[model samples]
Target chain A: MSFFYVDLSVNQSKTWEKLFFDLKGTKRYNKYCQDADFYNVFKQIILSLLLGEEIVLLDADFSEDEIKRLTANSIYETDDILVNKQLESIESKEDLFQHLRQINKEWQITLYTSGTTGLPKRISHSFQSITRFVKKSENHSSNVWGFAYNPTHMAGIQVFFQALLNGNPIVRLFGLSKEQIFESISEFAVTNISATPTFYRLLLPKFNQYPTVKRLTSGGEKFDEKTTNALKQIFPNAKITNVYASTEAGTLLASSGNNFFIKPEFKGLIKVIENELVIHKSLMGNSDIFSDEWYHTGDIVEIISQNPLNFHFISRKNEMINVGGYKVNPHEVEEAIREIDGVSDVRVFAKSNSVLGNIICSEVVINNDSLNESLIRNQLQTKLQEFKIPRLIKLADKISTTRTGKIKRN
Target chain B: MKKEKLLEIINTIKKNRNEVLINSIDETSDLRNDLGMESLDLAELTVRIEAEYDIDIFEDGIVNTIGEILNKLENKR
Candidate 1:
């Protein structure tokens, strides 16, 4: 095994030597697997390498049957593995490598897009693409990072590798509240932090106490004006940067001033065709998705000053409401509400909130006057996550549509 | 102004909001996570807290954790 790989599993007892031994013994993992790193980190990384297989990251809370059913039709159907089996199989492997040449250059993982507008799409990522932007240095050895994002997603994976590759300690923040997370960060002396703008908002109230946080990062949602200002006021000494990256396009741009300008080095990979930020196929993880040379990001950006690359993100092409950094697809919410018997036609959209960047709101055309707000809420609770469910549901006579006959989102 | 009275008022509000079960809340419990209270729910909570205590806890800023709310109420009185 190479020195690049580090064992940052839930248990610190799992060593790199043991990881190498486990990696060598593991067979081809062609089956569907959840990439949530709540347990053994080395096991999953090794399994991905040995098999050179793609791992889909579903919400960790997803049931075993749900995982099996989702991956049944995919290539991972035959030898699919669950969360527990993934760890056990790796720990059970014996043949350890003394010294390995290099990691697999092929695409190692498959990440699903947020699918805020529609159904989530599978995007392939290679080791090179994923680690392209991680600035690895021993200077970060003294720093302990807070693993805030869902480990299965792109941001989470980036933070994991950034700390692990440098042999830095990481404090897991999943299932922890804002207050608890702050306390953990303070207790652990966490120096580096990365999370979505919504996560930052939740942390703002208690942010002042964690003075040890030397680096701050925000992504996964639009790095809005309010958040940038707040972050500056809160963590004045910290080097703050809002990163712009997607599952399709691995890390793209960074904005220290809240106006994300395409970095000078990656200028060749970026293009602004007609207002939308289009990237060259080379920058994207899945190049095959692009029929043309450029992949459309669907995010509208305004170019302020060109030289060193200065641009500001306007808004998403589709009106996707980001609730506390979690992408809530309006269509999915509408579909869930539509399933309720009385709901005739529902148009779901985003309503801005001071704390949470956006909240899900719906205008519904109900058939029965007897159907009440609580009935709709009760029905939605069974189908959707609490964040995805609309905060306000109002009965409308009809849904307003544009000339194209599509429901108006704005 | 006692802690017990404040807890009672909070439990009643949490029960009515349907954000969380009354059995789940406690002094150390976070209002957002434990009660699943979003900004709107927090706003509703603020209204109830004000009505019960006759004090504007949120006049300073947003209060999230249950402990913070109790402290604010105690200090206000």
Candidate 2:
């Protein structure tokens, strides 16, 4: 009676037996445009990979124009060599699991970037590269995952592979409200949760502790000390970790805290050049953007220790706003605002101004209505320089997020 | 009325920094010299005024005095 996935929104659950049953006769598409339910999307990815076929995943909420732009208006076109391959039926769930564990093929999975800074780029990964960080052990079999990322993105694919390979049940928690997310976590007794810092920030000002969660993973955005501390309070029993991954590359580094250390096996595969993290071409997916041997990650990291080779993310290189000749990192400003009492969430960005080429601006979500622009400005004045403090502050009911759950920069 | 509103905005910015508030302002008062406002402060003043009057006082070029801001607003009206 092992369950595959549980959908709290519909109050429906699917079993491992049903997954195998559906896979027996499921129609396989070489280049699938999956804008369907989470169960179906997961099922299609598994079926395609099992048959050694290529698959393209698109966000379910993407507009028709966006889909056209991503696919170059060729959604139904397939250039895959394995387009005509037949789907093989497995006799039992054990056989399916065995196939997954022993599977090695040239099957490619395509994913689009969240496009926070500019247009999303399409990157393709081989089966081996996508599952390079997936761990399989008897201990992992008992862990229940609270899936909280978009199924079409890189982080979600990593979670799916990890859970599927370990035979763990996943409780869907993406796109759920703060109250609903907690409700699902308690109801399912979810043990492991992986999501962005923005997703975790929405659950701030904690009310009740969920001791069932034993592990929490933060990725896709900067995991600040404030959010990490709040997560510790909510998931008191969980061991929190941060994973560094991207659309261009799958999971590469994992850290117990905000600081990351390159594993001994991956020492040569990763390096830092002028503050930007660089990855070897061997570790990245197939994209024209990686013509060089080292792919510039465009992420700026601050080195914390030289002996242990420890570093932590600072901010994206493109995220720095030039405000009147002063470089302002919005993350720094946002962190200062987050430390202030009564603030639920804050998004600091740049606004085109006639005076300063670009002026720092922020939209803040606060629990206390008495928190006003001047009060926040005064508090920030002590922590940040005059140019770093946002020139314009707007109170928002909630901070908007991209399709991949990262805070919307624009 | 616009002059009073501009004075209030200026005082709010001053109050946040614990600076002495100015009760009255004239058209000839220099923003940087007389009011002791820096470039960042002027930037904030630009946005606050844009929010209130729907006009960017520094859109065309740098405005060094309250008279320039009021003139920008008056032109918009």
Candidate 3:
């Protein structure tokens, strides 16, 4: 157990310090925050629970309609936990530490994932399970981290805990524009950042210079080689690591280079069975899908070699496009399109068709005027089969992504 | 702009979306709520309708329902 203080502005600091004592916890709960005001209070409630209770984190957005559905279906009631109140109480740090010592050490948190293919699901993790990958050294305490995700999200909570656990300061990136993000980073002298590939892609052009960012991490989406190499050029001093993780599973694999390999000890814990990545039930926390010996992560992968085993992530099993009878992986097509000259980024999706069942549709972003429909189709015809070629292509100045930075395939 | 051709397009969209088609779809059918058509589904519907009718309904702006698409096709003719 650790006791720490968040360095907020004077007014908010006093408010949060009061919340540290007045806040309460429950057995299991669903947390939702509408905007930043709710987020500020919601985070403090989580902090109080982390110090003093055994709780389970439920999955759902902070939307009223979603809450209505969850309440109707699940055991949750809207009145079970309310957040509109002002918490004003105070206790000394020594007394807070005493209360923290009596709390359950095995208390767990469930991060609900908003997956691309279907409805969101809950992913459980203990404090140990989440902190397993975080660097335990005190040297990182001086680093100021930048935060961009919802505080309740896995990636977002990871940032908060990583900083709070190590006594570091975190600056929220919510509601900041492309320009404002860079400005705040410079203003705070943020030394570390962990965001989705989409976030970094948007920030690259706006980020003229930021000498303070030293440790960078990308997760919650596919990390491509092109973006990795570009970031390397920009953040010369930052040690960039791309990780492959899912809500069903915690941090499974990570690598700074071209490919991600299953960690040596986790070799048996994780395996690619019939091209689909599967993890031992021990890795996932309290999920119902783990009745079998291994939980099948629907993510697909390709094994590269044997002796020193290596593998590359493909696309999600559901995200694969079936044209007539032939299966076409979107990642394969996206990779082919990226190789073409002047093509900056591309998102390939399955466009439903009457005769073909589903046809390939691509949204291509180009930085230069050299790309056209015929030029792209001609280039892809050489690398891909005739059936795999995209039938509909839209040229756009930019590609849009989900909040977590994955290409919005839906 | 025959009703048969328009029904065929709606049915194709319904099938592609894996939604269960109740009755035969008509011009009055809601594309979003009734047919469960998303933005991606709407995009493909635009392409197929363009190919079949040789006129783009989305040329001017966004098209919402099956009725609006039929109106656009009729106006183009």
The numbered model that scores best in DockQ is: 2
| Candidate 3 Cα outliers beyond 4 Å, as residue runs | A1-42, A48-51, A54-62, A71-103, A306-309, A339-342, A369-371, A378-383, B1-48, B51-77
Candidate 2: which docking quality band? medium
Which lDDT value does model 3 have at A244?
Answer: 76
Q: How well is each residue in A93-198 modelled by candidate 2, as lDDT tens digits?
A: 5777877765557788998888776678999999899999999888887989999988999999999999988888889998887888999999989999999889
List the DockQ of the predictions in order.
0.07, 0.63, 0.04
| The 10-residue segment with the lowest total lDDT in model 3 chain A | A1-10
Where does candidate 1 chain A have its weakest 10-residue lDDT segment? A92-101
The total number of steric clashes, by the backbone 3 Å criterion, in model 2 comes to 0
| Tens-digit lDDT string for candidate 3 (A1-410) | 12232223221222334445545332333433333442354454455444433343443344656545533444343333434332222254434435434546656666557655455565667666766667646587677777766566677767766775565656656445776777767776778888877777666543366778898888765666677767777677789887776666667788885477777878678888899888898887776546898888888878897546688778788887887678998878888887776777888887665445677888998767876876787788789876677767789877877655578774
Compose the digit string of candidate 1's lDDT tens values, residues B1-77: 35666667656545434645465345787777776666756654555566677776667677767778778877875
lDDT of 3 at B28: 77
For A200-256, candidate 1 gives per-residue lDDT tens digits of 655553337457888888775554454465667766668888788887888877777
TM-score for candidate 2:
0.94
Q: What is the lDDT of residue A138 in candidate 1?
A: 57
